[model samples]
Target chain A: MKDIILIGSGNVATHLGNSLKKRGFNIVQVWSKHINNAKILANRLDCESTSSIKQLKKADLYILAVKDDAINQIISQLKDITIVHTSGSIDIEVFNHRVSNYGVFYPLQTFNKNVDLDLSKTPICIEANNKKFENKLMNIARELSRNVIQLDSESRRALHIAAVFACNFSNHMYTISEKILSESNLDFRLLLPLINQTVTKLKDHNPSEIQTGPAKRNDKQLIDSHIIGIKDAKFKELYTLISNSIISHNE
Target chain B: MKDIILIGSGNVATHLGNSLKKRGFNIVQVWSKHINNAKILANRLDCESTSSIKQLKKADLYILAVKDDAINQIISQLKDITIVHTSGSIDIEVFNHRVSNYGVFYPLQTFNKNVDLDLSKTPICIEANNKKFENKLMNIARELSRNVIQLDSESRRALHIAAVFACNFSNHMYTISEKILSESNLDFRLLLPLINQTVTKLKDHNPSEIQTGPAKRNDKQLIDSHIIGIKDAKFKELYTLISNSIISHNE
Candidate 1:
């Protein structure tokens, strides 16, 4: 587990590679289909860079950190190395016992290469085929993050779905908010305090329990006004759908 | 103004009342339709308390921080003093020129009385009938918050609408996430890192610009898998709706 190869050079790979390298794991190789992508991350990790999959160096662990579809293609090309992926939605069965040891090392955090992240605070979900490998993977995951959990494939899938609702859908709401504010020349920054408080509240309370607004209050009049003013068909539909969902959850 | 009477005793009222009191404003009286509510806030402010509208004290500024529907009823009872309501959706025209002094002092933040808040970081949206009073309201708002703006009814309404999408709708996303995780006996806290990162990213980029998910990547197979797994009719519908919305936004 001390020697590692990070198989992607995107945001997730960039963050994880640096974090693992910081924890004194030797990032033996950085691999991407594009030489430039591999070179960029390799430069940061001070490791060997490669666009050639067949040229990959043997390491104790090879993190298959690539696109979900690309996982199969890359894994099939390698032999006899422990492999794990950093995908929330992908199944652990993707390994199909290709090697003696394989697992999933999905970090439950959104990553942007340009943005700073405290990997120690992020939750890492680990899954392996056997107890021995699971312990090894857990130790590696624990080295980078204080929060690590051993999750099975089914539970990981459920968690991934929940992550979509919490992170992706929540961000879509912000997209819609930015659109609405732009129409009236209002700065998006005006909503920062309110946005900050919304997430801050969840630290202690359930989302439905602290829910407020016309939808939660079941104020039909206010909801009606919000729906009527929306000119974008998609946004209007979203407004009505979500407001009704909130009202339903309240009931 | 220096002298103020706070009408209402909810989260907004409690926060605004305490903030104004701390700023050295003389709170002549705290009034709520319920005597207990008035007494509770008054005890905290160390001021006079009243439930009777007729017993409301005369002050340089009267902040009518009641529910939106109750504004007209409460204002019809107050006379010969400056009046302002702290509502996001309600138009300032609700004042109807009944008094020489009327305005709105809407704070653009979701407040919880039990939660500690830094009011100076919150935005105060003020609107008044006359420039003299607008300046006065602005000065008072500035005292409480560094982020204060004199917004008109139309723009204020726009900002309010945006807040609903940003705060209320985003929280609803968390509600759905909690519901999904509960079905699998998974802890909701597992999603916090992802949730925190989602909001934290907005400080540097627009939501639409930073969007990343199956839908954002236009991965139809992943989206289909998610939609198919949802058992709740409302959630299934919501998943499809929001996914399509994200896809449409990406295009």
Candidate 2:
């Protein structure tokens, strides 16, 4: 069994800790700057918790799941340990310069403490500085997930940007939709099945091939009606921008 | 059994025809401006096909799923018949002005002939000139779906605009994502679960509440990376525009 120490207590850290425990790996400890947050997860895993990185115990694997800005500071505190950061943008070399052996164990999915994450099917992107550490990282990833992808830092960053488009920007569009529906005093629930089907279509068909809209069809009457319906000035601008983009794509 | 005649052979018409046939409606005939297209669906439904609206048979319900530009001409041709067009933008009065027993029977979902449409749960937005015709349209909708919503032309137009935001614009975001992934030689399948989860979150959580990413967190560094990574000029502009919207929402 691999012994792992999680060096943060945010969503990614808690989720990875819980999933690792469920996969029968020995979690050595969980450390967070916030003692309570660290203890919450540590208590669940029956592992020790420490607010001080000085008290951090040695483990076979160390996962740094801190904020993007705090990654360097966290790695500075570690001494000659095999480390990995669950960051999409940060390079693996950030840890390489600071530690003897390092890698990236980035899970390409959004996580929340409230949401039940199934790591088994979630894609884990792994990269290591050395062959030995790479094998160890790959093994751990394989044990936890069937979809382990080895991406160079550049590719991982590219994937991360793609996720921003697919997940983050997509969620913002839903937020706009919710706002639109709410203003009309209609329950956003009315849009759920259509939303579900939109995502479902992406599973089997390319999004470009299945795209439909007044903008895509160049139906100016519907476009004009839509633009007139938006009350928020900023949202109205967004509607016009995206609608124009869709129309541009068709052209 | 309601005898229905389809007056177009587009995605919406074909999908509705197949769905109605499955639900045991006698599709008396399909009339399209294009004879071959009408024949395609008519053969599938084991019904009659005709290019000329002059040869159309009398039916309890006539569905004009034609393009918006062609809607008036089709309705003018089928005057004195109980005709309804499945249009979100056009007023039911457009039909009432031409035909005595006219209404709107708009299905508030995106349709592609290749995709399997689940009509049982798709909300059918109905509007009519009179209560008798309204009841007739409602009865037909009720037989086909459980979620029959009554909206005036104004609300249906609002709902249609919201659908553009939630479905069409959101789909373009997916297309942007697919393009980004294709640049890296990565399969679009990697992003499917993230896309699915984004939609799943909308069912139980408000879209704004479930929003994540650099924009949601105001992570300037990651957002900068994303803007730089997207090579397409238009996509980059879209990224900047959407990220600004998300950040504005948080503020």
Candidate 3:
């Protein structure tokens, strides 16, 4: 069995560690900048834990699941290990001249530390420097997920940006909706079915094709009412901007 | 069985007609400003179709599923036949002076003509002036959906605005995501799994609690990179505005 070491204790690291352990991969060590977090994650997977880079034991694979900025600083302090990052935006070239073999093992899904997700169906995007190392990473990734594919750094970067709009910005829209409902003493729960159906529809149709609302219909009166109804200046500005965008995109 | 005459043949009208017909309700007639639309929907439901209000048959219920602006003009031509309008934002009292027994039977879900929704779990918000008519509408709504509840005009309006944010604006985020991916020669399909997981996470936790990405982290560097990377000025502004909102909301 190939031994793996996780280098972070955040959402991604926690999830990856758990899923890998479930798949019967030997997770040899877990490390984080904070000893407390490292210990917490390590205990769950029954692995060795450390805060210091010097304490990292020799493993077949080192997964750098740290923040985008922290990757450079952390990678700078270590060398000569087959490594990969789980970042969406950062280029694979960051490990150039620093490590003998490096690649990316980005899982394109939102992770929550407390929530348990079955990584089997989640898309595992892989990238590697050399053909041999690429095959190694692919073998391990296939063990964790059925949807493993080779994705280059350039395409991965584009996917990350698109993700910001789809997942992050989309969730922000939910937050804004919650805020709007709260102001009127209405329960946010009322919109849950609507939100679910919005996504459920996408399972069959393209989003641009299924787009609806005052903006898509160009119902000027309704759009104006919504703009005036939104009390927050920032939200109102967003309402106008997004509404106009929807109108234009549909046209 | 309640003999219903559906006004307008738009998304809501079409879906409502189909679901009601499936529930064994008698859809006696369908009407629209355009005869073509009315004929199309009416043919599907196996009902009489008309472009003229004078041609509307006498039915137990007249569901004015027309546009919000068109409601007043359409209602002006007909009265005193136990009517209801399926609108979220419009006042229930809009029917108070005109009809003897009128109510609101708003289905709180985004509708598409081609896609058939079960409506079994869909929340149908109802409002009426009297208990007799209210109960009558409730019975009908219950036949169509298990999630029938009484929500007044004020709360419904609030919920409508929130739906615009959650359903409409959130879908716009998908459109933007697709646009970004298309520009990079990346298949929008890669982002579908991510989008699915984003919504899937919400089934267990609050959106604010489960929120991820650079904005939630308040990672200045990553956010700056994304802003610079976004070629569209409007999208860039949205990125900044929404990123700031996420940061503040979390803090």
Of models 1 and 2, which has the larger DockQ?
1
Ranking by DockQ: 1, 2, 3
**Which tens-of-lDDT digit does each residue in A172-242 have in candidate 3?**
99888888888977667767778889998887777898898999989999889878778898888888989
Whole-model Cα lDDT of every candidate shown, in order: 0.90, 0.86, 0.88
**lDDT, residue B236, candidate 2:** 90
Question: Which ten contiguous residues of candidate 2 chain A have the minimum total lDDT?
Answer: A92-101
Please report the candidate that would top TM-score against the real structure. Answer: 1
Superposed Cα deviation of residue B213, candidate 1 (Å) = 1.0
| DockQ, Cα level, model 2 | 0.78
Estimated TM-score for each candidate: 0.98, 0.97, 0.96
Per-residue lDDT tens digits for candidate 2, residues B1-251, read 38999999988999888888888899999998789999999999899999998999989889999888788777766658887889988877776466788889999888888888788889999988899889888988897889998899888877887888889988888888788888889888898777777777776788889888889999998888778888889889889989999998999
Give every collision pair in model 1.
none
Standalone chain B TM-score for every prediction? 0.98, 0.96, 0.97
**Model 2 local distance difference test score:** 0.86
Higher DockQ: candidate 2 or 3?
2
Using lDDT as the yardstick, the better of models 1 and 3 is 1
Candidate 3 overall lDDT versus native: 0.88
